[model samples]
Target: MTLDIVRLLELTGWRAFDVDDRGRVLAGSDESGSMQLVELADGERTDLTALPGAVTGRYLPGERAVVVQHDSDGDERAQLSLLRLDRTGPAELADLEPLVDDPKHVHRLLDVLPGRIVYATNRRNGVDFDVVIRSARSTEEHVLYDGGGLVGEVAVSPDSRYAALTVPAAPALSDQLLLADTMPETRADALRELTDRRAAARHLHLDWLPDASGLIVTSDFGSDRTRIELLEPRSGRRHPLVTSDSCDLSGSLSPDGATLLVQANDDGATRLALHDARTGAHRLDVEPPTDGWCGHPMPAPVWSPDSRFVALSFSGPTAPGDVLLVEAATGRCHPLTFSAAQLTGEDPVEPTAHRIPARDGESIPCFRYAPHEPDSRTAGSAVVIIHGGPESQSVRAFSPIVQALAARGHTVLVPNVRGSTGYGKRWYSADDTRDRLESVADLADLHAWLPTIGVDPDRVALWGGSYGGYMVLAGLAFQSGRWAAGVDIVGISSLESFLRNTAGYRRAHREREYGSLTEDADFLRAASPLNRVSAIAAPLFVIHGANDPRVPLSEAEQVVAAVRDNDLECELHVYQDEGHGLAKRRNRLDAYPKALDFLARHLSG
Candidate 1:
């Protein structure tokens, strides 16, 4: 019988990203296969970007127009296009024109003001991102600051007099806030550190308290967990407003600036609460229905324009993410979406969380899903899917891929290895630079652990995307004889080339996670899979997007070539209309069947 994998893959939903000043929701959904812009208003849903490929969009403040990032296939470099949202009556064709037509470099819109637009681009310095300020009224633009890899998050004052920039301090390398003049006529130094180096290394600028009197930010200085602090940008004064026991704190100050929407992650589950931004007193708790994240547009608690309700995307182990409108005053919750109820398919196999100890005796948390029917393929065969972001943890989010694999009769285990997030800051930073390959070692622990669960050691396959894809390669390279087959989706072949060829916008920060080529080339070379591809004994299914900006096509191309040269079983599938991951439904339908067939042919021996 053919595996009905496509039906399982299609039963997932999206998280809300952008909400304009008018409170209309803009989400990137794969309901139609490709990533299309969706607008949610008055409980009515509309597909805005009905075009081809993936088109991510953000609202331009007053609901005037939307700035969308569209690229050819999966190439990370995108052209900023303007889709007029203020059109009246019968919608004319959105004459999509380039907002800032620099298709060669990544243009990130930081702050959009009435007359000025602040953005960052590496057009000039291919090595570092530079802040560029362009006038909204005209095509004229100028450099705001050329600080090399220092400037990141940008916050503007309500008066439009100044802009607060987050700068990474050297040596200690902590995040510090810096102030810069925004007024065109103002003759200031343009940029100056707003806070001293003694401050926290990281500060998530939440929002400028009403009238821009103070800035409320989440900082971790002198604390184990992040806490909200109000900072007097000009005077360099700071005071704590809210704190957490251990969970990472996030949320924003209300538009009225009276109450703070506080959301903290307790063991990867979000707990929502409201606190007085001024007094730091707890108002009420808006506990999340499930113990999962508040969803995308990561600042947590995305507030509506009126601030009457906070938009939250909550998910569970079984349910895909759905919107929740949590009333700010009473902390009472109302379900804004019934879409999560629409996901109907096979009997869902629930995952049980396990604290399996690795070879080093360090506790590794993972979620294991067992098949209902324990036939030969179901009992003996298994697959381990690694979450990408060596820093990102494998949380119990709504994952159709995991469920689909279990549906196809494979016991699935997702391990939160040494370098995953939601554990703590230390574990999150443990596998940086040279220690990354050790994460591949954690795969060995997973490989050994499978036998204890009745799965044959030889029947287990390894699969992952992005950094997880890198892990898949490392598994087949270093631990060759263990996995039955390896599925690499947009994974890195060489850590060195990834650091060099990745889009300029993501290169520096990515280097922070995976070592820099300038300083850690020797160690990176020793850890790369390209040098060890000769050892891969298992069948390999390599998949990549042609426009993948993060891992790049060259990584997939070279690895496939090297694998084929080794006279081993290898399959390479590239989707010309996808990027990074399989964002389109059509591509998924095409690719997943091939994957299911590949696993069945290799694992059912």
Candidate 2:
């Protein structure tokens, strides 16, 4: 059965920001260019079109007002607007200008402090973004940090006094963490340079202490093991917190700033441990469920608002993710209730794990999702969803998109291919430089493995965004006959051009991931989908944010032009005010339907 385009779109929860506090609920809805503020109070619902492009809504602690991040046309550009709502209804509190000038670039409100709001803006210029702190009421704006090498993590202290930013240099060199007073130009650089000479050292994780006096940072100091260090921000005095021999250390402090949680592998099984926040003394060890499918315990321990209860999402090799809420003091966990009926209206589909052997006999892990009913005709058409962060992994989770696709009767396989994290440093490092072809080969192998697993080979399609989008085009061009259709969103077509033209902050880190474009010309050209576009056989749907700083719209344009030149079926949809990913609900709603229509027209049998 062909999927109902309209029904599928409806199934997609295109939600905007909604805040409920003190029995009053304010929701942002799509109403032309302006957002409709739906106020629910005393069983009466009143819709007010007060703000434009309302993306998120937050209720201030004491003010009883709602601040929303909104844009005029529901495009990429968004501004924070304060709204005062009471018995007299909703009124505009403040009309604040956007921190960044580029409407197409991505801007995000980092955190709301005592008197100010911190925001970060990423432009096509590079990875290093402009950090701005603005007054909640006045036009007073302060540019804290700019023109730094690609910034990774930015965090503001709970006291609203200190701000920390991590900057990555070369892979072997130590990264710099900058700590500054939230109010002024009192930015002090804390360089965590390695004492030992290493060629590829990089800062992996960073966290600021609650006291705002120090920070805990994890770094790869020319070894497989990650070293954790606690450093005083003002004195620059560093102390070794923990060091492992084989497994990497990954975790952070609890929200209340009382306990530090750490995750490390013990005999191939990931273990979770809690440590004393101040002295780094081992406090508690929580044993995760031992099941064949349960591979390792994730580091994510969701802290409650008060930090008394810790919620966790755990999964293993064969096990689906199970949400558990644990008492912080006792470490006793209880299963949390997640209504699958409300989200998918059915029990969530659990992934079937398989280890697909790579070209060199190296086993690559993958998860396949198909309709629970084997007799269902919607099973044959498959969408091979590639994940972003060629460096990231596809973990077990309640993904709305993946579940929605499965509900529509299509089989989905998410491959952890090459360059994905979670396996080990060696597995991740293998895909670096020119080894991207192996990642491409891994996709073809999965396509070939589909029929053996009772899936239709001919009705297969490819889809992904960001790095995954690049994989979509790669699969089409290299493994041409395998996929029936392809959807590439903000994917790179030309690696060389992408490296040269990408925003500044991102370009600084490109050398470690893809290698320098100047030094590895041949390898980059071979990796580019644009260079091999003549080999494409499948119909293509390319989507991109026109203002994307990472993989610019040029990548999409070049590939679309090349595919059209070859007379291959291709369509390009560019959101003028979007970046890397679609922010507006309307754009997302519009893009997915068009993509579904394209895939159904080509791949559905």
Candidates in order, TM-scores: namely: 0.89, 0.74
- Model 1 RMSD in Å is 3.3
- The 10 consecutive residues of candidate 1 with the worst lDDT sum are 290-299
Clashes of each: 8, 22
Quick one: best lDDT, which candidate? Answer: 1
Task: Please report the TM-score between candidate 2 and the true structure.
Answer: 0.74
**Following a full C-alpha superposition, what root-mean-square deviation does model 2 have from the true structure?**
6.3
lDDT per residue (tens digit) for residues 396-508 in model 2: 64455565677667888888888776665666667777777888888888887888877789999999999999899999888878889999989989888999888655677
Which model scores highest in TM-score?
A: 1
